[model samples]
Target: MKKPLVIAATLAVVLSLGLAACGGDDSSEETLSNSELIAQADQICTDYNEQLDTMNEEAALDENSSRQEIATYISDDLVPLYQEQVDELRSLNPNEEDAAAYNDIVDTLESELQVVEDDPEAAIDAEDP
Candidate 1:
C-alpha cells in the first residue's frame, strides 16, 4: 500500500518547512535586516520546495511499489533534503525581533524529522499520518 503515513508525513514536513523562514547565527560579519532575513528564508523555502517536487517526480512510485520502497524514499531522499534545508535556514541570521520564532520553527522541524527517522515504517504506518 502507498499508505497514509507517507502522505501525512509529507504534509507535516511541508508545513513545518514553510515555517523555516527565519533563523540566525553569528556567521556573517554584517547583520541582516528583518526584511532581508525574510527574503533569504523565502528563497530557501522556494528552493526546498522545488527540489522536493523534482525528487517526487524522479521517484515516480507506482501502485505496485512496496511499502519499503516508499519508506526508503522518505528516509534516503526526504530526510537528507530536509536536513539540508534546516541547516541552510539555521545558517542565516534573523534579527532579534524574529529570533525566537525562527528557533521554534527549526526546533519543531528537527523534532518532526526525528520522529520520521526513528522509525520509517512506523511513520509510514501512523494512524494519523
Candidate 2:
C-alpha cells in the first residue's frame, strides 16, 4: 500500500469535483447571479482544500503504516470531512434551470464517496486486479 499521507492527497483530488455554487442566506430565498454562484463555490472549495492540508499534516503517517491504519484514517477522518463539503455544496440553491444538473453532480459525488466510505481498503489497494 502507498503511504497513508498519499491517501489524503488522493481524497483531496476526489473531493474537488466541480462545485455548482448558488448563493442565498440560510433563511431567505434569493437568486444569485452566475458570478455569485461561482464565487460561493470557489470559496467552499478553497476552505475544503485548506482543511485537507491541515488534516494531511496532522496525520503524519510514515511509509511503514499498515493498510488498516490508512483505511481507518480515511474512514474515520477523511470521509466525514469530504462528506461535510458535499453537504455544503448540496445546500446551495441552484436556479431552476441549473437545478437538475447541479443535483446530478451532487448525486455522482455522493455515490463516489460512498464507494470509498464503504470499503476504504479498496482505496489503498493499488495492486488490485
Candidate 3:
C-alpha cells in the first residue's frame, strides 16, 4: 500500500508538469510554413465571410456590427500581430486560391463597413424597399 501511494504521487507530479508545458501560450513565435500560414488565413477568411453573409441577410450592421468586436479584434489582435504573416503568405503565393478567398472576405467586410458608415440607422434595422 505504501509503495503504491508513492508511485501514484510521482505519476501525478509528472503528469502535471507535462500538462503545464503544453498549456503555456500555444501561439508560437516560430515562423509558419507558407502553406500553414495560408491555411490559417483561409480559415479566418471563410469564417469572416460566413459571418458577414448572416449579417447581410438578417440585419444591416452598425458601425460596431451589433456590438461584435470582429473588426476591432481583427485590427488589434490579428492585423497588428499577424499581418506580416498574411503578407508573407500572399507574397510567397500571390496566385493561390486562398489569397483570392481572403480578398473576398476583405471585400465583404469593407462593403458591410461602408453600409454602416453611410447609413447608421438603416444598417441597424433590416427593412427592404
> In angstroms, how far off is 127's CA in candidate 3?
24
Best by TM-score: 2
Decide which is better by TM-score, 1 or 3.
1
* Lowest-sum lDDT 10-residue window in model 2: 19-28
Off by over 4 Å in 3: 1-27, 60-129
Worst 10 residues of 1 by lDDT: 2-11
Clashes of each: 0, 0, 0
Candidate 3, run of 10 with poorest lDDT: 17-26
C-alpha local distance difference test of each model: 0.69, 0.71, 0.35
lDDT by residue for model 2 (1-129), tens: 677666666666665555634431121376555566567766877888888888878987677887777888889988898899888877777667666766677787788789899999876764322
Across residues 8-86, which tens digit of lDDT does each residue of candidate 3 receive?
Answer: 2222222222121111111345444445644554554444445434543443323434323333333333232233322
Per-model TM-score, in order, reads 0.78, 0.84, 0.30
In terms of lDDT, the best-performing candidate is 2
Model 2 deviation from native, Cα RMSD in Å: 3.2
Clashing pairs in 2: none
